[model samples]
Target: MRTSRAGTSHTVLWAGWAALAAGAVLCVIGWYGVSGERFAERQLPYLASCTVPGAALIVAAAVLLAHGRDATAAARVEELYALLVAAEPPREEAEGERPVAGELVAVPGGTLFHRADCPLVAGKAEAGPVDEHGRAGLDPCPVCAPDV
Candidate 1:
């Protein structure tokens, strides 16, 4: 099953409790049975067998918890980026300004603000740059920040 941080912590704690209980049971048995040997000496090998699986479960739980934490952190980072680039306050268009504004987007290079249908260069005061795609660079719109 998938384990989160709390799950891992719980697993580890339960394993510890089991170990304690097992030891205690063995101790009670020893005490009641009259014996001249160390409490665990009689059945140490059999008791030791459970340790391997218990330890493995604890480690797996810890790793899953760490992964969950990392995912959470990445989500927070994306949210902060969105907040950083909120739409500019409404304003009158300057005489020289273009009228294009792209929506905030996440790109491989950086956040882009534009429509996917139109290239970042389209809808600019100046002409779009000519390239293999002939897509224009984003224009500097007075109302919104378009890639120019």
Candidate 2:
């Protein structure tokens, strides 16, 4: 089975959080070793090493988290596009007559309905025809300004 984009995004997000937590813990341990009166001076070098690497890990984790969030957003947009494509009417209907007000075309997943010849409908692979009367909940497309 193929792994879903959402699943991958969640995994990346959680991994980033885990890395951040580990980095924080390491930084704390390093700080305690250097500052605590009970620790010997000889341990300072090792503690400094831990502190530097821990800071790097924290930075890496921040970048990973941001990447995961962007991936999730992109996945959502793709899913919406797929839904819109699935809602399109048959090819014959699309090629034939001009759509009336109640017969306006729209993507089922989208919020707005558009005229058959609307400029926005031109290169969108996911765009399809939907009846305004049947899809009563969809609003008019602001750009095309269909009478529906």
Candidate 3:
């Protein structure tokens, strides 16, 4: 079974947060070694090294989280594109289609209007775009609400 994009995104976010927590702990330990009266003076050099790598880990984690968000957005767009392609009517009916009517897609028995790429419109018959004056009774899809 393939993992969902949302699941992957959450995993990345959690990893980033773990790295940040680890970095904070390392920095605190390093600071304690350098400032505590109980720590020997000679131990300062070794403990100080922890803070540098801890800071680096925090930065790396932030970068990973940012990329994860970008990837999720890209995945959504790709899914939308696929839905649009599948919902398009066969070419024979498109030969005489009006220019304004080709922009949107809807189901035959549904009461909602949707953008051509809306996932809800997938596998539904195309009713073309909503008429500018005939949209009084139809509701916009909550997921991919078309700007009717």
Highest-scoring model, TM-score: 2
* All candidates: TM-score: 0.31, 0.54, 0.48
Candidate 2 stretches with Cα past 4 Å from truth are 1-3, 37-43, 90-148
lDDT digits (tens) for residues 20-120 of candidate 2: 99899889877876776455776667576878778988998999899999989988888888888889675544544545434467765888888867877
Residue-wise C-alpha lDDT for candidate 1, range 1-148, written one tens digit per residue = 2225445555555555565565555545544443434566664544444444445545554565566566556556656666777757545447444432333322333323344224543434333223223233322333344344
TM-score: which is higher, 1 or 2?
2
The predictions' CA RMSDs to the true structure, in order, are: 12.3, 9.7, 10.5
lDDT of each: 0.45, 0.76, 0.70
Clashes of each: 9, 0, 0
Question: Lowest summed-lDDT stretch of 10 residues in model 3?
Answer: 93-102
Clashing pairs in 1: 102-113, 102-114, 103-114, 121-136, 121-137, 121-138, 128-136, 138-147, 138-148
